[model samples]
Target: MTRLSAAFALALALALAACGGQPASEQGHADEHAAAGDHAEEAGGHSEEERHADGGGEHTDEQPSTTIPADVAERAGIEVQPVGPGTIADEHEVQGLLTPIEGRVAQVTARFPGPIHALRANVGDTVRAGQPLATIESNLSLSNYTVSSPIDGVVTARNASLGGLADEGAPLFEIADLSRLWVDLHIFGADAQHIRAGVPVTVTRMSDGKTVETVLERVLPGMATASQSTVARATIDNADGLWRPGSAVKARITVEQQPVELMVPLSALQTMNGEEVVFVRVGEAYQAQPVEVGQRDGQRVEILSGLNEGDQVVVEESYLIKADIEKEGASHEH
Candidate 1:
């Protein structure tokens, strides 16, 4: 009986050895895994090649165009604007204050140290060129010297009173024309780079948001001590007496500008995979189209290529378009 059992066990062991170590189901699973690995390697290589061809290389700045459904874009507040003839004024919005033009302001001062003999032009008094602001009895010369207004203006400040002592070049009164003024705008960093003489600027009063057109006269070569920003000076005609000096205001200084046949708002521009992109409406899908951008102002950007007149472009909240395109790509990879 023991020999018969031993023979049966030996026969079973020999049969298992003939079929290999694993069951048929297990063997099948192993074979399937190996096939899958080979297929994955093949697919990964193909995807890499496609990506490189489609401008997906690490140093490549061009991005492959993608698309999003029209309905989805609309729900995401992706506003579209038609590309057509428009003026793109490369402008910057900056804070400014109305200032009196230098030649229009007169700081009436005595040439020598003296005592004020008489005060003629008080604050709020209008005076003309050579009009006496005060008569000073000089301490050195001991003669009464007439300190007169150097320009036709109204006296805005009076520091010397009747019988007051005055030092040489001590301002007795300040006279300002107030007819012509300047918008002293402080622009920092890149905004100050292009600002120079002859650029058109618009000065808006901060009190009531009143706007007046003007041209930038010149940019101060030095920066302000307190603000650390360069000052851009624009001369504004104040003949109407509406614009006042020393008042806070806002200015739109056009730095660079060009008229273009087609343009889009700055908000419409998006960077995708190191390339500038804008979503354009096509049929029922919004195509994330790579674009060649040109002279861009503060508000709009010139579309040099990849778009045409009357083509609708996504202007607002375009990140949703980018996200949807990326999601679709990930799904296809799986």
Candidate 2:
């Protein structure tokens, strides 16, 4: 009976041990599942944070849009104006130099062979007509010293010096009346037809920025052998002595005038595809319009076609607009 009791007790201990092991195994599995769920929640939260940081927009592989700087635009002093139908005058361009009017230059000479005693006038000296430029002691029968000047002008050349001998008709001095000057221009063969005597001309000195208004004095009878261009003379008044003889000058001669045509400032036109175009203001942007151009004045251009009167155009900073259009075009091409 005691042995039976011992076996029964051992069985009871075994049953309690089995029950404890099962509970411990079940708890470990539950803990592992809870950790896995927490990991999944953390991963989902990270993905959402990334999307918010990116502004909820897909990143594109494209160049960012650019614009002109405000400060640069302001500094450019851009201006705008309208195209108006008006008279247009064509001009011909020529290169020329300054010279005295006809018969105004004089060659001072001794009436008879003599020796120069003294020279009162030097090159570049202003002298009046009959002013004594030099004193000459005669070698002829007269044997007397004489003083003389033949014209009113600036002495441009002097051949007589003190104690120098002079021959009859020898040049003692060269005097030129600089009050009036001439520009001898070479007009191209094709352009020569429009040029005529008495045409109004505008002369400009590129060095000094001085401009003179004059008229075509004459056109030489022949063309230059080397350049095959005709010579056209333009005469200008130089009372202020600003137009120096032999100074280089540019001449613009008005050739023909059209009663009416569409006109715009020259600065408003830009070259595109070997054709002239103007940027017309449209809302906040500018659209380039191809134009047919005719004659151009100093700061204005004649628009023959492709534009109407009263079209608002950009007179300045038009190149900036052109650049923007080109850039956009290139981007599209890419």
How many residue pairs clash in each candidate at the backbone level?
Answer: 0, 0
Q: Which 10 consecutive residues of model 1 have the lowest summed lDDT?
A: 57-66
Off by over 4 Å in 2: 1-72, 140-144, 206-209, 224-228, 271-276, 282-301, 304-308, 328-334
On residues 207-249, what C-alpha lDDT tens digit does candidate 1 reach at each position? 9989989888888999999999999888888877788778999
Deviation (Å) of 30 in candidate 1: 69
Best by TM-score: 2
TM-score against truth, every candidate: 0.49, 0.67
Look at candidate 2 and tell me the lDDT of residue 277: 78
lDDT of 1: 0.76
Error of 1 at 316 (Å): 18
State in Å the error of residue 252, model 1: 0.8
Candidate-wise lDDT, in order: 0.76, 0.72
